[model samples]
Target: MTPNDTKPSAVTVRGLVKHYGETRALDGVDLEVREGTVMGVLGPNGAGKTTLVRILSTLLTPDAGHATVAGYDVVRQPRQLRRVIGLTGQYASVDEKLPGWENLYLIGRLLDLPRKEARARADELLERFSLTEAARRPARTYSGGMRRRLDLAASMIGRPAVLYLDEPTTGLDPRTRNEVWDEVKAMVGDGVTVLLTTQYMEEAEQLASELTVVDRGKVIANGAVEELKAKVGGRTLRVRPADPLQLRPLAGMLDELGITGLAATTVDTGTGSLLVPVLSDEQLTAAVGAVTARGITISSITTELPSLDEVFLSLTGHRASAPQDARPADSREEVAV
Candidate 1:
């Protein structure tokens, strides 16, 4: 069985709602994160992604609805809930004044770990996160990736059953991002249920088994990765011309082949590529042959299922990671929290 099919929900949210004055941060959002798996909450800025994380993390009281993390009510049993949940927001919240090892040890102590156990845990995490060599150096001396890893280590110091990661890999390089992804997979392997909120489609696809997409304070879509991809016309032939300006013409040419659904959805302006539904190998071969026959040069060509970005755009009329006022909503969310 898939993760969502068999495991009970580690977290459950029913009719969740939160408003910031005139702005509806969350509008009756319903969600579930299966035990020992990652539930990706995907959305753009100002879409209330942070609001949902705040409520579930017990940092903010919802205006309406009920949520339970690890069987503890967010509002009614916040202290109990806090014991089982760990949060890592978009930016690292580590103490730059402290060394890496000290940060983990301090958080461990704060969680009531015994002095010996805290020290042991700190040593273990520093080694695990590849910070052992620089454990004694102040956090401000570490690289961006190092700082992020240190922050991640700090969150796991409590061995919490459920972790809330709110856009945790927002501004990292691809290598560092992959490192974080590996760490997330390792957490699930250890049976830690994770609620990951991110606006990056690639990140959502890489880490999450299932996704809940929030837009304008509502869950517009929620399903397995493949299920969401299927909704936006699955297995599309991504045809990118040598010249971006030729995209419309390429679509027109593809439509001439009479592929039933090719005409309606063609140009993904965001990527400047045409996505033609791939129904069968024979159809794809025919389409490729036609393009070659017409002598239309292509910069790239591939047949793949719909990406999470397309699925997201099809569900909500916005790009998942478009440029925006850098984390303004997040700052406001922290204030609200």
Candidate 2:
């Protein structure tokens, strides 16, 4: 059985609070991460996600409440806590001039590994991250995805039990993002507990076993992705008409079907699509028949669960904006790790 197969909690927090002057960065935040699983902290920019991470990682002190990582108190055993946790932030921290192997080797030395052992560990990590071919090349010569893998490798030099990844793939291309996702999945397969902070719902859905949504310094919601989606308005039926002008006609047909509680929202002219909030599988079946009866062609039609974006809006009364690296109002200077 894997570490996640066990019942122990890897990280725990309760009634956490933090403030910078008048602004509250975190307030009564609470969460628990299962061992060897990924717990995603999902939120928009300026939602205290980073503040909570800083406190949990022992880089910053909370004003109140308690937190523990790897069974050690975050406040009282910070040094020991740091030893058991590794962190990778929004940007890569690798030195541009250093080769990939050197970066990992340097971190191992910093963690007090003997020279020969550090070198061996570096070689092992390079092979594990699939960077052995590029191991000797300057980090500046590597692509964005390779650089990110190198950064992740550096964080693992000390073999931390819990890893903290804060927006680890924020600016990468889709392919690169997937590459990093694969790496993260591989890490979890090796029993590394992860706490990933991200603003993108897709990222949370892709990697997290459980998620906690924070907004304006407080946790607005928490659950598995499916559970959280159910808390929103439930799944929706989305249709993309084959012909742009058919959108209106399709909506009219759907409304005219006399199906109870089936009201199609206005068509989005730009995308030639219409979204209908669905309360049951019966409504989806009725919708399909209605469109077919009208002889209207649709390029694509599907019922999808409420996305993380909708969940955020429903819980917080606002939609998530574009992804950014902005921090909460109470954010102060970076606390050294």
Candidate 3:
């Protein structure tokens, strides 16, 4: 069964509303994060993605509706709720002056672990995150990736049942981002329920078992990654012309094919490439035939399912601005975490 098919939501929200004076940050939103799974909240800046995380983590109160984490009411039982949740914000929240080991150990002690146990846990996490050799060095000397891992390790001191990750990989490099993704997968394997808000579509595609896409403070779409992708009009047939001038010509040829549902969606990137939405093998075959018959030399041809970026564009009427082409996360390799 899929993650969403699991019973007993680790988090639940209903008609959650939060307003900043005349501006509504959250417009009667609702969401569910199933037990032992990652629920991705995907949106652009000012989409209220962080607001949702804040409410579920007991950092903010909704003006209307209710929310619960691990069966503890966020507003009514915040103290008890805090006991079961962990939060990692967009930026690293580590103490730069302290060594990585000391940072995590201090958190363990603050959580009331005994001195010996805190020391042991710190050692264990240092090794787990491959920071053992650098454990004694001050955090400011650590790399960006190392600092992120250290911050995550600090959050785990409590071994929270629910973890709130608010854009945890925002400014990290691809390798560092992959490391964080691996850590997230590890936590879910250990039965930690995760609620992650991110502007990276590939990040959501990589980590979330299911996604809730929010725009203007309301849920615009919710489903598994593939289910959401299917909403972008299915597989897209793409062609790169050998001659740069052939790009628009190829698009015109496809438009002249008179195929149903083909002309209106064709996109010319104005860079010797054409993207056409094709639903079936028949439509794909026809497009290829028409282009070749017109003597348009093709550099390369490919057909791919719609990406999360396309899905986001379709739902929100704008593409989520992401760094580095916004390609699929699966196309890249992860740093050994």
Candidate 4:
């Protein structure tokens, strides 16, 4: 590969559209990913997120659109495009009967690597992914996290210029998810452009340099995480009174602060609180003052910015934890609660 081959814009899409019978999976979507940045495509279950990734990764052709991967047009230059992009779908694709090392070596050989080179790459990846200890074990015996790491290693056999990860950490525990996140960060540091599709807000917030949110086959919002959060209204004020009996007074004070719709609910076991969504930082401060003036001691008072889940709900008229089948084909299923 020449220096020009290392240049960016590894994935680009314009006016992309795809359909399944009467449902339009992608409707006039446009996206651009820089050479080395991680771009997140986020949406609820039905929100065309997978469809878009599928088109850009060359797994599926678009009905009416144009895309390019590493300067090769997806439709006209698919063979060349395949050489530069790596795609890991929602499920792991490794052969369970093969040992971890064997799986990696096989992929390397399939990529046309010399036998010696393939073995070397396999050893390197096993060590890099902390799988060297289990390198000889059948992949089916590996834990979910380990299997995911091996799957990722397989995708790198060709040293792809761009990587597409569809919900890479969907079923792993928190520790394993963080491990995968670290690997993604390392990839970005090494100058590989990544396009990630995930419903997890934390995943997007932690990994993506930019986010594009799809709803009903259209881009409902797109920007940096903070910028997207800002568009969803304002800060939220949460106050927990030391005495559960004081809830009524706290509610009244919140109402006096011009914050209507104040509601009381148990925050957790042995904790009672009132939550009111406020529109501004000023409202938060004023509400705090009024609560103090009422002689109610505040057990805790905090202001929180709207989360990505909140943004999704506000834009799509449904909570993130709602059923997937309830959403339109172009819409995303709510993020898991």
The candidate that wins on TM-score is: 2
- Report the C-alpha lDDT of model 4 over 86-141, residue by residue, as the tens digit: 88866678999999999999988887889999999999989988999999999999
lDDT, each prediction: 0.84, 0.84, 0.85, 0.79
Task: Please provide TM-scores, in order, for all candidate models, with all chains considered together.
Answer: 0.82, 0.82, 0.82, 0.81
- Candidate 3 lDDT over 41-110, as tens digits, reads 9887778888888888887888999888899999999998887899998778999999999999999898
lDDT of 1 by residue, 1-337 (tens): 5646888889999999998888788899999888998999887778788888888887789999999889999999988888788888787899999999899999999999999999999999999889999999999999878988998898899999999898888677878889999998998899999999887888888899999988888888888998888776657788888888888987887777786544344798889888877766677787777777888788888889877778888888886774232345344344331
In model 3, which runs have C-alpha deviations exceeding 4 angstroms?
1-3, 238-256, 264-275, 279-303, 324-337
Model 4 alpha-carbon miss at residue 321, Å: 4.8
Screening candidate 3 with a backbone cut-off below 3 angstroms (N, C-alpha, C), the clashing residue pairs are none
Ten-residue stretch with the least lDDT total in model 4: 323-332
Model 2 spans > 4 angstroms off: 1-6, 238-251, 257-261, 265-275, 280-302, 321-337
Residue 170 lDDT in model 3?
A: 71
**Whole-structure CA lDDT of model 2:** 0.84
> Where does candidate 1 have its weakest 10-residue lDDT segment?
323-332
Cα deviation in Å at residue 102, candidate 4? 1.7
Clashes of each: 0, 0, 0, 10
> What is the RMSD of candidate 1?
5.1
Clashing pairs in 2: none
